[model samples]
Target chain A: MNTMNNKKFMMIDGLPVAIEGEKNILDVIRKAGIDLPTLCYYSALSTYGACRMCVVEGKHGEIMASCSTPPRSGMEIKTNTPRLQKYRKMVLELMLADHCRDCTTCDKNFDCKLQELAQRFGLKKVRFEPYSIWDKTDNSSLAIFRDPNKCIICGDCVRMCSEIQNVGAIDFAHRGSKMEVTTAFNMPIAETNCVNCGQCAAICPTGAITVKNDLGPLWEDLHDPNVRVVAQIAPAVRVALGDEFDIPRGTNVMGKMVTALRRMGFDEVYDTATGADLTVIEEAREFIDRLENGGKLPLFTSCCPAWFRYAEINHPELYDNISSCKSPIEMLGSVIKERAKQQETGKKPKKTKVVAIAPCTAKKFEIKRDEMQYEGEPTVAHTITTIELANMIREAGLRFEDILPEAVDMPYGIASGAGIIFGVTGGVTEAVIRYVLGSSARDHIADISFTGVRGFDGLKEVKIPYKEQELSIAIVSGLKNAENLIQAIQSGEAHYDFVEVMACEGGCIAGAGQPFVLGRAKPERADGMYEADRLSNVKLSAENPVADALYTGLLAGDKAHHLLHYK
Target chain B: MDNKELYQQIDEIINAQSSEKPIVAILQDIQEVYRYLPREAFDYLSEKLGVSLAKIYSIATFYENFSLSPKGKYVIKICDGTACHVRKSIPILDALRKELGLSGEKNTTDDLMYTVETVSCLGACGLAPVLTVNDKVYPAMTPEKAIELLGELK
Candidate 1:
C-alpha cells in the first residue's frame, strides 16, 4: 500500500482508494463511489450512529456502523452484502410501522428522506402492526410548525438548535416510548425563548418541523379587487429561488422571479435590495455620527430578525449596542406605505398591501412586530418565504422557466452593488465600508471589495485603516459563534468598532426558507451575489440615483429618522 | 409557600451549592423543598445557572424521580420487576388504587394523601411481590394484605 500525503491506500470492493486521515470508514467508502444509506447522519453535525442502515462488513465478518468506524490501512470493506441489505430493509420496515404514513397529505411528501429510503431499499410491505405515537401538532410559533406525529426522533432539530444556534429552546424529553423533542416544561414554543430562526425546521429530515404556511391570507389579499398588492423580493431570494424551479443553485433569477410575481397578480414588483441600499446609507451615517460623538462602540447589525430576537431574549444587556436601523425588508415596507399614502389624493384610497418575498421565516414574525407598524397597521401587510413564493407560482399555473424576464417597478426597484451583496455573511459590513469610502475617502482607496470580511468562516475579524484611524470589525455567522464573540467582548478579551451577526450560517443566502441544497450552498450563493455586484454599474449605495432622490425628496430630516430607525 | 418565600428558598438552595455544582444537584434540592419542580424555580435557576430553560426541562423530565406536578404526602411504590411480575404485584397495585380511589392516570389522590406508582425493582427479589408505602416495605404483599395496610394508614 503506497502512502500519498500521509494517506494509506486501501482496497474497497475491488478498486484501491486513498484514505487521508478520515475519522470514519463512511467518508472513505463515499469517496470510492460506494454510497452508504444513512438517516441520522448529517455532515454539518456530530455523528449519531442510531440508524444502522450504514452498516458495512469487514474482512473478519464484523458488521459495524461505517459512520462511527475508523478506516484501517489495507482494509477490505464490503459496503453492500445480502445480510446488510436485509438488515437495512428490516430497519426501514420497523421505522415505517411506527411512522405516520400520510405521504399524500404530508408537506415533505416528495422531499422526505424516509420515503426515499423506503423506495431505494425496496420495502414492499411493513409486516409489523401499526403502532401510532401521534402527538398534537405544535403551531404556537409564528415562524415554525411542529408535528410530533411525523417526527422520527432523528434529533436533527434538537442538535441544530442547541449545538449550532446556541439556542436550546427545544430538547429531547422523557425516554423510550415517551421520548419527544419539546420546549421547556412542554410549553408552547412561543412561550419559550425561541428566536423563530426556523433553523430547526430547515434541518429537519421530515415534515415534523416546517415554516408556517400563510399563503391563504396572501392569496385572499391578492384576489381582493380593493387591495393594491405589491411585492418586494429580498436580495437573498434572487440567488436561491431558482432551486424551486429546477434551476441550478446560485443562479440569479431576479428578472424571472419578478415576472412570476407579476403573473401571480402582483400590481407592482420591487426589490428589497433597494431597501438595503437605503440601509447602507442610513447605517453609515449612524456609524459616522457615533464615531465623531463618542457613542457606543461596536454597533451590531440588526438586519437579521433571529439575531435581534436572540439579543433581546438571551442578552438583553447588549440591546442598546444593536443598531437602530430597520432591516431592509421593513425599511422598504415603510417606504412603500409612505409612497402609497402620498399617491392617494383624498378619498380613502385602496389599501396598498406590501408583500415581502424573503428567504427567512423570521420575517414572518418580524413584519408583525409592533415596531414594524405605521399608522396602526403593519407596513408589510404579509410576508412569505421563497418556498412559499414558489408554491404560489406553481399554484397560479405559470411556467417559471418559460416566462420572459421582466423588470421591477420604478422608485423601489433599482439597487446598487452594495445592496446586492447584502445576501452574504460579511456583505453588510463590506457594504457599509464601501458606502463610507465611496462617499468620503474615494481618493484614498482603490479596491472596494473588502475580501477580509467575506467567506463562510464562523467568525471573521478585520482591522482596516480608514481616515488615519484603525477601525476593527468582526463578522460572525451562526448564533453559536455570535455567543462566543459576545462572551469574548464581555470578558475584555476582544474589542471591535463594529460587529455583524447573522443567525444563519451564511446569512440570508442559506436562510431557513431557501430551497434545501446539500453540500456547500453558502459559498456558492454568496459567489452569485458577488458576481451580481461585479456586473453592476453602480458599486456604491451613495451613487444610487433612486436612493439619492428618496433622501433629497421624501425621506429627509426627522421623518427619515422616525421611519428608518427602530428601538 | 408564597411566591417570594419560594423564590428565596430556591435562591438559598442554589447559593448553598458551589458554583461548579451540576444542574441536577440544584434541581434535586429544589424538588426536595417544593415536592416537585416549580416553574418559578426553573425560571430562577435558568437565570442563576446560566442554563437555558429547555435544557433544565430536559434534565427534569429525563429522570424518573423528578416530577413536574405535585405529589402526595405518601408515595406507594409497587415493584414490577421480573420476580414481582411473575409473583403478581399487579393485583396489589390495583387493590391499592381501588382503596385509595386513585385512577391509573391520576397517580395522586384528590386529597393529596396517597400516590401509587410502579417501580422496576426494589433490590429485594428474595421478597417477591414487594410494595412500599413511603419508607416502610411490605414483603410478600397480596391484594388483601395491601388493602388492609392502606386501611391501617387511614
Candidate 2:
C-alpha cells in the first residue's frame, strides 16, 4: 500500500512509488523497485550506512549512499551501472573475507538473503583471505544460536532484539574488526531473560543468528523399530499447521494431523491437549491449595518454557512460587513413560520415545530439561513445531488430508473446556481455577469464563472471589512483558498472588515455531486463534472426559492428590 | 587512600560489576573516588568478582570511557557531537595536545593525571563548547580554560 505522502511519488525504472517526507534517495530507490544493492542497508528499520554497498550514481557527478542520501526533486539515479555493481560486489567480497561459508550445516543455508545476493552477483569465492580468526558460536541459549564469524556486521539482530523484542540481550560489544555481539558482562544468553522468541532470527539476513534444529533426532526415532514413539500435538498446532500445508488458517485438521503422524511412522498419536487437560487438573488443584493453605497466593503458571526460563533468570526470588507442574508436552512425556511401564506388567517397560508436535519453538528446549526425564522414556525425545512438522510430512510424501482423525489413547487422554484454553494467554490460570477450586465452589464459579485474562494484554491482572478466598492472578505473555512484570515485582512496584506467563506475544499460536508470515500478512492471520477457541464445544476444564477418567479410574477420588498437585 | 587501599576499593567496584549489570554503574562512580583505573585495583576485582582476568581486560578495552592504565591526577572529557563539533572543539583538543605533549590515544606524562577523550551528544547541545573535569561540566569552554584546567589538576 502506498503512503498518502506518495503525492510527490516518481517513477524509478517503471516502478511507481511514494517516498516518506525525509526519506533519502536510497529509500526512494528501494521503494521504487530499483533494486539498489546494499550491504549494510536493512529493510524494516533505520539505515546505518556502515557498509557502502548501496552506493549509486546521482544525476550529478557525486556518488552517494542510496541509504543515507536524501532524494532531490529531479535526481536521476543510476542503481546498476557497472561501476556501482562492482563496488557492491567488492563490499561483499570484503565481508566474506571473514564469513564462514559452510552452507550445508549452516542454519541460514537455503534461507540466507546474503548467500542469495552473492549468487545473484555471481561471485564464486571471497577474493580476500579470512581475517579475525576467532569464530564464536555461543550455544549457551536453548533456542537462538549466535555465530559471530558469519556476521556481516549488518546489525539486524541488534535492531530486532532491541527494537522489536524490547530485550536488548545482544549488542555490538567491541570496536571495528574485534567487534562481536555480547550480553551484559558478555555472559551467555541462558544467564539473561532472552525469552527465545526468535524474532532476532527472523530479522537476521545472514547466518549470524539462527534457531537450533532438532528435526534430525525426530527422524532417527521415526525409523527406529526399538523406539515406541508417540506424538502429541499442541492445541495451537491445529490452528497453524494448516497454513504450513498451504491450507487456510484455523483449519481444524485434528483428525488428519493424527493420520499424518501415524503415516510418518509413529507408534501412537495423542493430543498434547490431553496432557493440557492433565495440566489443568494439576494446575487447578495447585491454585486451590495455594488459595486455602496460604502457599504462594498468585502462583505463576509454568506452561511456557521460555517464560519459566526467563523467570528463573530474572526473578530467582519467585522461583519457589512457580508451578511445579510440567507443561503439556512434559506432562505427556511423564504419562507416556508411566503408561508404558504400567502396560508391560511384569515384563520390562519398553523404551518409549515421546515427540511433541508443538506450536512453540521453546518446546524443543523444554523436553530437554534434566528434570523432565521419565523412567522408561530415558529421552523425552524430539519435537517438531507446526511448520516444521508440515515440512517433514511433505518430505515424507504424506498428505495431511489423507490422515484420519483418531482419538488419543487413554489414562491422560481427556481434558476440559478449561484445558482447551491452554493454547491462549491466560487459559492455564483460568482453567486451573475452574477445576481445582473445591467441589462446593467449583459449581458456584458459574458457567461463564473469566474472560478478563483472555485477551492480549502483556500483563493482565484479575481478582477472583473463590468461595471465601480472593485469588489474585496475573497473566503475562511475551518475554518483554515478562521482563517488565519481573522488574516491577523485583522493585516492589507490582504484586500478584499468581501469574500465568507465556513467552510468545499472542501465546502459543503466535509462537516463534508457528508458520512464517511476512510483516504485511500477520495482522490478517492474527485473529485466527480466537476463531479456533470459539468453534470448540467444550470451553471449560470440568467438562473434559480425560480429566473425568483420570479421576475415576487412575487415582479414584484422589485424582487431585495424584496428578493435580505438584511442586 | 594509599595505593593498597585504593586497590581494595577498586576490588569492591569490579566485583560489583562482574556479578551484576547494576554494579557497572558503581564501577563508574568509584572511578571518581580514585583518579584513574589502576591495574592493581583490577587484580583485586578479579579475585573478588570471579571473572576471568582476560574478560576484565576485554571489557576495559572495549569501553572508550574506561581507562585500564593510570591517568594524571585530573581527567578531561570533550563532547564531539554536532553542536560541540560546530564550536570547533578540535581546537580545544589540539590545545590539550600542545600543552600535554600527547599525540595519540593515550597520554601519560609527568606526575600529571589527565585522560582527554571525545563523547557523543551529552544532551547539552546549547552548552556547545562544553568540557568536563572530573564530573563537573564547564559550559561555553574556551581554549584558555582547557590550559587553565590542566594547571589546576592535582
TM-score of the second chain in each model? 0.91, 0.76
lDDT of 1 at B109: 89
- Who wins the DockQ comparison? 1
Give a tens-digit lDDT track for model 2, residues B10-109.
6566555645644356556566676556666554555555443334545665776776566765567788889998998889988987888886666656
- TM-scores for every candidate against the unseen true structure: 0.95, 0.70
Candidate 1 lDDT tens digits, A1-567: 546677797777767789888888889989888778887877788888887889988888788999988888888878888888898999899888878888998878788888999999889999997666678889899999988887878888888888889998998888777888888877889888899999998888888998999999999998998899999999999989888888888889999998888878899999898999989988988888888889898899999999999999989998778899999999988888988888996676788999999999899899989999989988998889999898898889989989888898997768988898898988898889987665653432235454477878899988776688988999999999999999999999999999999999989998998987535677779889998887877878888898989988779778788889876
Per-prediction count of colliding residue pairs? Answer: 0, 19
Top candidate when judged by TM-score against the true structure: 1
In the range A395-484, model 2's lDDT, one tens digit per residue, is 899877666677665555554555556776776766666665545434543432554766666778887767676667778776667767
Docking class of 1: high
DockQ comparisons of all candidates to the true complex: 0.82, 0.09
